[model samples]
Target: MTKALTPGSIAPPFARYSHAVEIPAGHRLVVCSGQLGIDSQGDVPPDVEGQTRLCFANIAAILAEAGMDLSDIVRINAFVTGREHLPGYMKTRDEFTGSPPPASTLMIVSGFARPEFVVEIEVIASAP
Candidate 1:
């Protein structure tokens, strides 16, 4: 079983994640492919908020396929078109990762292949 990060004002709700993950030996890790904001219909959602939400949903589905959840995530990476919607991005992230939240890296890029597309996400999870 995996343990949530210990709580504290200064601590990241959990003790370890990504570069911060501190698991012992004898455990398995599951790394997920980068998830996009596209729907199962293969349609990329418009708007950063919508795309970000869809990306997390896609990530969740992948985690379930591997018998894991967002809490088991050690590291997360998010790429966006620009910084205009960053605060909103954080809000979208808060919905999936609450309390201490996860170790995340957010980047702003010039654009994506699909012009309508606004975001892409990736995650790494491990267990004992």
Candidate 2:
């Protein structure tokens, strides 16, 4: 199992995430590429919340392929087009993540490859 690391000496995380995670030495790691909001049908949601859901769904599928799941994720890096999307992104993220939520970083970027995409997410998962 992975251990969530949030030292008392440092400030607590701003959101539902740990500052770091300790993955056991024998675990296998899966690094997933960033996934945008588009689905198999190439449909992109216009709202940040909808798009954020799709991103996590895509990441879940990718982890499944590696014999892992969302709960196995140890770290998450997410990007949104603007600060306005922060609440939607964080809400959706909290819904998908498991207990002792993974260490995470959320950033605001100018844009994505496609203008319609409002969010993107990437994750690192580990399993024995």
Candidate 3:
């Protein structure tokens, strides 16, 4: 299992994520590549909410292949095209991560490999 960490020496997390995570010994890690909003049909959603959901859906598919789920995620790196997508991102993330979410980093980038893509998410997961 993965444990969320919040050291008293440091300020608490500002949002839904922990400051760090501790994965138990003897566990292996599954690091996922950045997941884009593109669906199986090779179509990118127009809205941030749909794209955000698709990103997680792609991530979930990858995790499932590894015999794990979102609950095993320890860290997440999100790259968004604009800051306006924060609220939608947070809500969608909460839908998947539940309580004690993974350590998270949000980056506002100018663009992505494809102009139609609005968001990309990458995760690091623990596996026993």
Which numbered prediction scores highest in TM-score against the true structure? 2
Clashing pairs in 1: 5-13, 5-14, 5-15, 17-20, 17-21, 18-74
Supply every candidate's count of residue pairs whose N, Cα or C atoms clash at under 3 angstroms.
Answer: 6, 0, 0
> The CA-based lDDT of model 2 is what?
0.93
Candidate with top lDDT is 2
Q: Where is the poorest 10-residue window by lDDT in model 2?
A: 51-60
TM-score of each: 0.79, 0.98, 0.95
List, residue by residue over 11-112, the lDDT tens digit for candidate 1. 443222322445557867788877778898988756778888998888888888888877777778888888886877777887887434556788898877
Q: Residues 1-128, candidate 2, lDDT per residue (tens digit)? A: 89999999999999999999999899999999999998999999999989988998999999999888899989999999999999989998999999899999999999999999989999999999
TM-score of 1: 0.79
Evaluate model 2: give its TM-score.
0.98
lDDT tens readout by residue for model 3, 30-123: 9999999899999888988899899899988999998988888899999998989888888888888945789999999999988988889999
- Choose 1 or 2, whichever is better by TM-score: 2
Error of 3 at 61 (Å): 0.7
Stretches of model 1 off by over 4 angstroms after superposition: 1-19
